[model samples]
Target: MTSDKAHNLWHQTCAEQIAAPVLSGDVTVDLVVIGGGYTGCSAALHAAQLGASVCLLEADEIGHGGSGRNVGLANAGLWLPPAEIRKHLGDGPGDRLVNLLSDAPRLVFDLIARHGIACEAVQNGTLHCAHSPSGLKDLQVRHTQLKTSGAPVMLLDADEAAARTGSAAFHGALFDPRAGTIQPLGYVRGLARAAMQAQALVHQHSPVLRLSHGAGMWQVETSAGSVRAKSLIQATNAYHRNLSSTAPEYVPVHYFQCATDPLPEELRATILPEGEGCWDTGLIMTSFRMDQMGRLIIGAMGDLDHLASSIHRAWVRRKLIELYPELQDVPLRQGWHGRIAMTSDHIPKITAIGPNAYAAHGYSGRGIGPGTVFGKGMAEALLSGNDISLPMPAIEAHHERMTGARQMFFETGATLTHLIKARF
Candidate 1:
């Protein structure tokens, strides 16, 4: 999660600090945004730039949620393949969303450069390594669909993938040169700072206790103050509090990461030297990347603070050793976990809750890119009163059943996998 603790690595080196105060006294604005993750910040930035009076409120510091804790791969598209997206959505909307997300990395990187965000932006690309032959087959299907849609993705054989990844543990890889990684927390904070600079008011430590719509304005009440605005956006995603019973619901998934201390000289040259981040095609995915300081950051799905913590940690140690025996002694000293909002279709949702009020959630694991893009779309749609301009049509409701049981089931499966893998 975007953390309450300043001990997080991204926070330590962050370029932007939270300078906004809590919502003080009553204020009126054109737009009021809740949850200071990617979407909220982006929306605030865009709306303010468009000359709208905007105020953004956060429960904690900006990006102190999944936006700060994500793997930071500015990937293209949703977890579902393009064909599957068409099956879920009709052709026009599906194709539009696919095309928009295809350029998500471009948008994210552009913002970084445009804003001079101090986050380490590595655009060398990412590798989807095949975990097995079946995984390779899945890549093949994905590759065909991507190629058919004019994407410049390339598939690498075992030898090529191994040479690039420095790990001979996969059948092949699908390489997307368009995508890359970032220090997520820093990036999100930078966005908030930029939004503030553009005249958007931001408040931290301003959790909204109650939200109501009445008298031609949406009102959010906080301990410090209340905000009344013509438009409101709920960008909380997975870290959502019970702000409204009518808010969209999604399955909450947990992902955790541990980073080794900066590698010694000899080891730094051996792993991911090409600067490409990677994730495998397993049932439970694993991601590996090198930070600007050469710390080998690896992550998997499971909360590090929960009952499965030990099993997950042990498995991480063994998995690192299995991937690269050269750094067996290096310690993974830092561990953190964050939540994900997962929709049933693995696609993001734009919900129209009431007049001039909207909520977006469920990017699954692809939040950075989608969240940024979705926020921009939300701003444009709300400001212009044009729902048809959105990438995906805004629906009245988005429903996901049994989120709690589903979350438990996913955690249990991850725990069992880690235990068996560590022992075997």
Candidate 2:
């Protein structure tokens, strides 16, 4: 389904709107990016700025995927904490990645300012809230690890967190002063606009029909036209279409969000007073943030388009009451869901799919900052003919076992949790 029909708050409220002509006729460029999400658009923009001819093709409009339907938290680092990342990727590479991503928010906000992106960029920071005592301990460990890495994070006590969040539901919170929120759809569309301004050819509604690499060049074909490029970057992430053989393998996890009408001034003064985005430390994670219009957006892990949609929606209503009893009667105005490409290890992958083509995916719900960083790094690496600049080494291929079953397990778990956990 197209983003317009999804009832997404981002689509309705996005300030940055753009349109590009569909791909027609043959075109050749130095780089051809498939997918017009954050990574693809950023790659095209940076490549074109560096004087490389670039063309980006998207099946739908720009930001039509997870980029448009994001939680809008431009957070640092991956879903995995620093210590777990070290356990997975070794100390050297893990530290490198952690350091790179710790500054990712700066990169995101800087790009927004530099390109004059109309995304509602906010850098007030974010709260990793504690849903329970155990969750508080988890934040303690994260706080220690972050401090060890020289990060400027503050651990807020329950009272402090309650004052900051305007809700007494949290046990504690780990505040990362570096992160923030944005209008996600606006940001991605702004990236596409900036890329176009930099002389990159971006085509919407141009779904890639076939992908083949031969004669040391990558050839991408759509319904009406084709592009042959010296290098390629596939940034389709969760909403991949048409090219299964080249698609990144991951378990598909669904996330849905519900937004209330812009809260009245008195209510707005209490919720998220500092405007920091928030997500609780629950297995079936829940996120909270506010838009420029003062609408409170709440999200959790569950598909709203499936048979269990009623349960999920019911849970959202109950959850709003559970968090803020004052909003017990506030009706939800918008609801939408999006897919996440979750890898088993919770690490993103950059796969060397062909001679000079790489496919990046598996953000696991941490999209904005990492997507921008990886996209620019991929563009630089492709242009310079050196992989040294990449955040992680490109693997030849990646595969996940029991993807379908795993996806179902996630959905089932979320459904069960929402069904029984948040009742007031």
Candidate 3:
């Protein structure tokens, strides 16, 4: 059972649980990883599998941050369309990233099958639903671009989309056979379990107090213990704390989700019958999916702790009725929120903090596939002394300006949008 402090549905429903004692003494290893989210756990697992002695430290429980609180869509690519990605990063690098992430869902599912992770793994597919006519046009372009890049994607018109989603609200949808969903917290915890089986030391409630490097070794100090290693990986993302100098810089946007009680079998038979995850094309995006027990999960961009949280909640209630009038009386069973490390260009980044230490962040809300792939790539690069396996070259530093302003802009915009847009 999950601790009472774990207020999210994922924690309560997660089938995988790992018990890691807090650090109490000094330890030495080839690599020391900070943070217990997907990237950190994946890095630890891959590094250990490569025969590197590894130590992973987490400030809280595994998947305590965004990894635990996300919408559970193990999507295939970034939020930006292919052309926009190419525009931000030129053709060569853009195409490379696109191709790498195009097959990311396969990598994720294969790992689940190989490790026997029981995280409600489903490989059916995902839908990019169109919220408006303009949104349909956008999906049309995305379908063309994805197909041009060899993705087996199908564009569905209004009738087809309505039939698949069990709602007449969407004008269309783009179906990608490569994408899927999972119980995210369970998946991350499963990775940690696998890493432990490979002889990696994992410590929970071990926050790094200070870090220093000299003579080709990193000295990481925590409250109760310390770690010395030749390399380090910081995978904290938006939940980073206590390490300001080396922490990633990005606009911290919040995303909140609400889940309903399991619907009757008849209702479940009609809604998302094929078990595909879904999200719509809107500036303030919304996501929808069903858990293994038939609970309908819906999410949007906004902070649930803000004063405007009531407005967001009200909007969700009304939005549910708008999408499915039959669900008008269904009360939300759980609601929670997490932060996203968003970049101006909506791309992930790997920054070289020091000689052999790297900090990766800025997934812009596309965490699962990219995080796992980047973590494995980082482990390979660090252990082999070659970075050719990395999807993108690591940079010296990455900076984001007006991050506070941008974060507020997103929250305020989401609040205003939710306040007025979903009314009957």
Backbone collisions counted per model: 2, 0, 0
As for TM-score, the candidate ahead, 1 or 3, is 3
| Model 1 segments more than 4 A misplaced | 1-7, 422-424
Model 3 TM-score, all chains together = 0.98
RMSD of 2: 1.2
RMSD of each: 1.6, 1.2, 1.7
Q: What is the number of residue pairs that collide in model 1?
A: 2
For candidate 3, write residues 20-130 as lDDT tens digits.
Answer: 999999999999999999999999999999999999999999898899889989988898888888888889888988989898899889889989898999988999999
lDDT of 3 at 262: 98
Instruction: Evaluate model 2: give its TM-score.
Output: 0.98
lDDT of 1 by residue, 1-424 (tens): 3223543566665666768898889999999999899999999999999999999999988988988887778898888889999888999999999999999999999999999897899999999999899999999999999998878899999999988888888899999999998999888998999999999999999999999999899988999899999998999998877676865688888998888899976777878878898999999999999988999988899987786588898999998887887878998877777899888888899998889988899999999999999998998899999886577999999888998999999999999999887444
CA lDDT of every candidate: 0.88, 0.92, 0.91
Global Cα lDDT for candidate 3: 0.91
Give candidate 2's total backbone clashes. 0
TM-score, one value per model: 0.97, 0.98, 0.98
Candidate 1 residue pairs in backbone clash: 2-64, 2-65
TM-score of 1: 0.97
